[model samples]
Target: MIKGIYVHIPFCHQICSYCDFNKFYFHNQPVDAYLDRLDQEMEHWSRKTDLSEVHTVFLGGGTPTSLSLRQLSKLFDSLEQHFPIHQITEFTSEANPDELTYDKMELMAARGVNRFSIGVQTFDARLLKVLGRTHTEQHVERVIQHANDLKFPSISMDLMYGLPNQTMDHWKDALHRAFQMPITHISAYSLIVEPKTIFYNLMSKGKLPLPAQDLERDMYDYLLTSTKKHDFEQYEISNFAKNGLYSKHNSIYWKNEEYLGLGAGAHGYVDGIRYSNHGPLKKYMSALEEGNLPIIHQNFVTEKEAMEEELFLGLRMNKGVSFSDFKRKYGNDLREIYQSQLSKQIQLGNLEERDGRLQLTYQGRFIGNDVFSEFLL
Candidate 1:
């Protein structure tokens, strides 16, 4: 069953230095045409799947808040037409702190958007400039205040560490400022210099002075400790939430369940086939114009591949993978299939079987990639 719906808004007011997502600048583009095509795509999917079963709908970026009020309304109108917007338990829209105005927030709230995931990479002005972010600390404060005033059920912030010239003290300061906000959740990630990004070019030229590996580790350690102190539970490896306010949409992905991915450059996994849509706006719209799905590439997941994914993706959660759930899903004993790897990790003290759940230990999270790789049969 498709438990979630993820709509991609591939337009950003300003492109960040380290971002490699499929997005374009928001100026002089066919914004209305794109929204129209997006609506067409949703209409097409609605014919094939029962969208009413979808419990969560996530509006991810570029920046969903980059749209004008009218554009947002048009998009919401389409969403309501195809899906039960009010029935969705968690409706989240990713926002840029500078772009999310008071009126926009009101429109989103009226449209049943219960969560705002603001992109506030860092509180430091120098770091914001380095990251190509236009929002200031004050902008973030005002946005949070507005969301609170409107009484949004859940407000979340995305933060990044290990940026160019970032120090331990810088990371600590960002965390402190983040805890001060009236947010229910925080998703913090370390910077990775992906190809085709400004950071990648600078890294190639030795111009990006990133923090050392040890310092990055220390930053992550401090993050785990500090968020716990602030009464936020680490539900996922990088996601912390207060009062059990976990991101239900993201949890669908972690649990390896299927979802419908709409709009240009979106990806979806449905009926054991994982697929991504055409990224170019024209190509995406052209496919829909021809009454076809905009999928560009797809692969049918084999049973072996599914089991591998089950382990790696499920291990990312704090609860880890349930042995019984694995057996029920795959109809094989989890202990027999990856017995050697599980034993190796458990003996190494990186993993443990606690109450039939194979989970990562404190030591394992630091070397998570290395540990997860061992399960690839």
Candidate 2:
């Protein structure tokens, strides 16, 4: 049973240095063609699954907001034909302020989009231009105000730290500015140089310097403390949400529930099988038009491997994994499976076993991946 759905729109206004997410610099010519294929895929999938059990739906992307109001309206029309639209609890779309205006927000609202996740990487105008962003800080403020005026159920902002040429103070300033807005959620990302990204090439050319290791660590420290100071709770490693506002769609993925992914480069998991659509836009459309699923690869998740995934994905949350859920799923106690590994981590203070549940300690949050890597057979 699929509990969630992810829609990927692989087009962005400008490429960022550290971003490796599947996206291409958007040109207007391909918009209609791409959405046409997306419509076909959604129609096919709607017939493929029952929509009764679906709980949450997310529209993610290179920047979904890049689509024109007309295009977005057509997309919502296609979505309604396939899924239980009113049954969806959370309907989120990733937007950029430059492309998102009052008209676009109102169109999405008219189509029942109740949640928005706008990218506001920083408030510094110079740094924003350096990052190749088209919008100014003022644009973000206006977009947020408009979304709030619509009475959207939730509004989230995305922020990044540890950027090239970013100082500790600059990082704090970004967080400070975002908190000043009426946001119910915040997603923080550390700058990572990814291959083929302009940011990666700049680092390779020595034209930009990454934050020092110690400074990066301190920046993360600042994130944890400042978010806490703002009365936000860190539900996942890089996600903070106000009370009862955690991202339900994302929580489904981390919880390892079966979900469907649509559009180019989107991934889906169902009945222990994991698969992804073709990454290339043209290739994806061609394959689907030929009546194929456009799937590039598929794998079966073994019982043992699914368990390991549970460990890491669950631990990414501050609450960690649940023993009751573990036993119910595997007919095996987690402690019995990873007895030594768990013991070693607990001794190192990276993990804690308390209150009939397991969770990561404070120090564990920083080095969590390291601890998890050891258990990834």
Candidate 3:
């Protein structure tokens, strides 16, 4: 049974320069139609499987808060009707600082949305402009303050480092300012310029000047140290939480559990197959209108692939991969399948077996991509 649901809202008020997610400008789009199709897609899922009360539901975007107050209400109502909201321990929605108003916050609270993940990329004005973000530092403060006033149980914000013209001092100042907020979670990520983004185009033209590898590493180290000092525990590589407020929805992905993915450009894993829906808006809506799912691709995982996924995905968490759990699930010892790779990583001082789990050491965290790559068989 799927324990989680991820709904993709592909509409954004403004596009950020570095973002390459599946999104479109909110203006002049068929917003209501898209929401209707999303609802239909959920209904489609109910037809295929016994829709159980999901543990968590996350509405990620193109800025889900970009919708008008009425639209947001309709969207939430539709979701509650399709997915059992009463059983959800966590219901998170991504919001932009500028667009997240008090009315929207009240609506969210009334509808049982307990968590808010606001996009506050950087507190610096210059860096914000460079990233194509329109919100100022004041907007972030205001939105977070309002969310706190509403008594939302878990508040999280996203920050980015390793950007063009970003420095250690800028990063430090941002971190200092973030700790002042009433947020319970922080997700700090290093910038990666992907294809089809403004940053990628600028780099091709010799216009972008991102920080060096060593400086980026310093920023990451500072992030870990600072969050730890602030009484926040690092749960995942990019995620840190105060108290025990780990993002349950995201944990599902890292734990390699099944989830239902709804809306355009969403991907899902159910049974043993991983599937993705049509990315284009028109195609996604038209498919639902014709009473068919917009699934464009589906891959049935072989045992070998499943085991490989178990390593890379599980290793993403600080708790690491469980040896006994792996053996119990696969009916084979983990060390026996990749003895050479495990020994090599251990010998290199990058991996350690502790508390009946195999996890990355401090050195391995720095070169995590390389360590994860070695697990591919």
Candidate 4:
């Protein structure tokens, strides 16, 4: 059952240096036409699949709030018309601090949007500029304040560490300011300069001055300690939340559950297959216009691949992977399948078996990518 729906709005007012997501500048783009095509795509999907009441509806970006008030209204109107929302417990939209205005916040609240995932990046003005983020620290403060005032059910912010010239004190300041807000969730990530991003180009030319691996690890340590001290549970490696405030939409992905990925550049898993839509705007819109699903690539997940994914994705959570659940799902014991890998990881102090679940140890969280790689068949 596809219980979650992710709608991507790939339009941004300004591009971030570290971002590599498929998006175009909001100025002078065919914004209304894109939304119309999105509506048509959703309608076509509904007719094909028995999709009605989803548990979560997430409108992520480039920046969903970049749309005009009228355009936002039209987008939601299409959503409500095609997709039922009364049963959606968590309806989220990602917004940038500068563009997420008071009026837009009000519109979201009125439209049953319960969660706002704002991109704060960092509180340091210099770092913000280096990251090519246009929002100021003041803008973040004001946007978060407005969201709090409106009493949005969940207010989550994205923060990044391990930037150029960023120190422990710099990280501490960002974390300190984050906890000061009346927010429920915080997702902190180490900056990775992916290929094709501005940061990547600068790094290639020796112009980027990112922190060392050890310093980045130290920053992650501080993040864990500080968030825990503030009574937030580290539900996943990078996600911390107050009691019962876990992001339901994100959890759907971590649990490897089925979801519908709508819009260009979106990836989704349904039944036993994983699929991605076309990333380019022209390819996406043209497919939809020609009464096609716009799916550029898809693969049926083999049982072996599914089990491998189960370990990697499930281990991202603090609870790790359940031994019994794995056995039940695959009709085979996990230990029997990867005994050598499990024994090696445990011997190396990177993993442990506790409470009938195989999970990453505290040490393993720091080198999570390496730990997850061991599970690959």
Please give, for residues 133-214, the per-residue lDDT of candidate 4 as tens digits: 8999889989989998999989999999999999989999999999999899999999988999999999999999988999
Worst 10 residues of 3 by lDDT: 45-54
- Positional deviation of residue 283's Cα in model 4 after best superposition, in angstroms: 0.9
Task: Give per-residue CA lDDT, model 1, range 1-377, as digits (tens).
Answer: 89999999999989999999899999998999999989998888888886657899999978899999999999999999988776799999999999999999999999999999999989999999999999999999999999999999999999999998898899899999988889999999999899999999999998999888999999999999999999999988999999999999999988999999998899999989999999998899899889889999999999999999988889999999999999999999999999899889999999999999999998898888899999887
> How high a TM-score does candidate 4 get?
0.98
Give the per-residue lDDT digits (tens) of candidate 3, residues 1-377: 69899999999878899999999998899999998898899888877875574699999988899899989888987887877788899999999999999999999889989999999989999999989898999999999999999899999999999999998999999999999999999999999999999999999999999999999999999999999999989999999999999999999999988899888999999998999999899999999999999999999988899899999999889999999999998998999998999999999998999999999998888888899999998
Worst 10 residues of 1 by lDDT: 44-53
Off by over 4 Å in 2: none
Number of the candidate with higher lDDT, 2 or 4:
4
Clashing residue pairs for model 3: none
Model 2 per-residue lDDT tens digits across residues 1-377: 88988999888877765677789888754877888888888888888777688988898888899888888988898888888888988899999987898999998988878889998888887778777887888899999999999998899998988877789989988998888889999999888777888887787888877789889899999999999999899999999999769999999988888898999999999778999999888899998789878789999999999999998889898888999989999999999889999999999999998776788899998888898886787
In candidate 1, which residue ranges exceed 4 Å CA deviation? none
TM-score of each: 0.99, 0.97, 0.99, 0.98
Can you give the lDDT of residue 4 in candidate 3? 92
Please list the Cα RMSD from the true structure of every candidate, rounded to 1 decimal place: 0.8, 1.2, 0.8, 0.9
Query: For this target, which candidate reaches the highest lDDT against the unseen true structure?
Result: 1
